[model samples]
Target: MTEVCFVGDADCDLQYELLSRETAREALSTYDLRRPFENAIALSTVSLGAAVSLCNDLNWYVVRFVDDVLVREPSVDDDEWLSRELATAVRDGDVTGPDTGEYLKVYGLEEPEPTPEDPNPKGPPALVEPLYVSRQDGAVPEYDLRDVDDTVVVRLTEGEFTV
Candidate 1:
């Protein structure tokens, strides 16, 4: 099954509870992240920005953001170390770490399957459509998420992630 996670607006204390869901939330949490090998693509608002800043800081590839997707094509050769460093930077909230040199890899993919509307699109459309919260519960929509490719999507719980 595709793995996923979700991130919501949370305060400092709330962040802890949120992280707890990282492993427990359904195999597919609310967050939908793409594999960083098709070309190190970032596909969310925060991650996209992180990718761009990482590229600029490390002189890696030019990170491109088309809608919610972010793409970085390594500008230099042998960017394996660079990519790993960038990933660390992103995880640690540092673009240029003392341990990680100024470089990034071009491992993430640039193009995913194309939807009819976004032809030759720079990136795939948003993973989660606007949430349709319903006070009345019976009409909630559902998605099977059985056949998605190269993606990890987390499921949601009673205001939490189950893993």
Candidate 2:
């Protein structure tokens, strides 16, 4: 079972509620997301088409939408993004905190399987852009998060992140 949690979109109070089917549905219906509920991709297998649908539907960038597993090779841009993150982690070292290998060891498979030379290369397309919410006019979507109960929503609180 593939799991996905909203990574960005912090300003949208209902984002935390998006992890649950019932709550996600309620939030989707209540908000003016402009995208159809039929297209939402939270907690799903995350097919390439589904990734595209979620990214395009939510006006998200191709990297913000993350999945629990590596469903396919990341887009060139996403590969660069992950590389930068890895560089920063290596620079940070134990002095910075926990080890960062947890990410790269698992996700980096840039050298596609079957080597593209194999007559039987079977899998997702060679290049895949991750699903992500785009930057909205260079500004974060601002919304009041006071109404939602903390227990029901699972997300980092406003203070836990730097805008």
Candidate 3:
């Protein structure tokens, strides 16, 4: 299965923003939604092609409410995620799964605050600012921007590399 995760923009409540609209809601109706991160929503698709197609179908809402779009294809790397652009490239056969891990955007994941409504947190950790890095000798550097218990690494295309 290919998992697609949408990180919400800080200013908006992502779930409400997407589900409130009829078009976006209908487009996402078929899949089961999961909140993997504090401001994120995730869904599974059968293949990389399906994941990219769904993202393209919801581009309007994504542009307005999402901060990032990440896809995880088990055929690629089970632990690491791919940027939306890279995922699309892979789905289209422009890039190979093995060649997708050179450039990465690493986001620090902080522990979530326990809320009164939901005390026992089952959601994934919250994401912080991402640090762009390139792998060297098949090893990626640790995220040093802040103190985080975990990190989410999103593989990027060379064109998407920022630093």
Each candidate: what lDDT? 0.30, 0.28, 0.94
Order of the predicted models by TM-score, top scorer first: 3, 2, 1
Predicted candidate 3 versus true structure: per-residue lDDT over 1-163, tens digit per residue: 9999999999999999999999999999999999889989999999999999999999999999999999999999999999999999998999999999999999999987679997986767899989999998999898999889899999999999963
Tens-digit lDDT track of model 2 for 45-139: 23334433343344323234322212221321222122223322333342122222122221112223465479566432221222222235533
Please name the candidate that would achieve the greatest TM-score relative to the true structure.
3
Candidate 2: TM-score? 0.22
Per-residue error (Å), model 1, residue 92: 28
Tens digits of per-residue lDDT for model 1 on 1-163?
2111122222222223323454323322444545343222333324434444433442311222111222322322122222333443444565333333222111122245667996665644323322322223322333233333322221122222111
| RMSD of candidate 1 to true structure, Å | 18.2
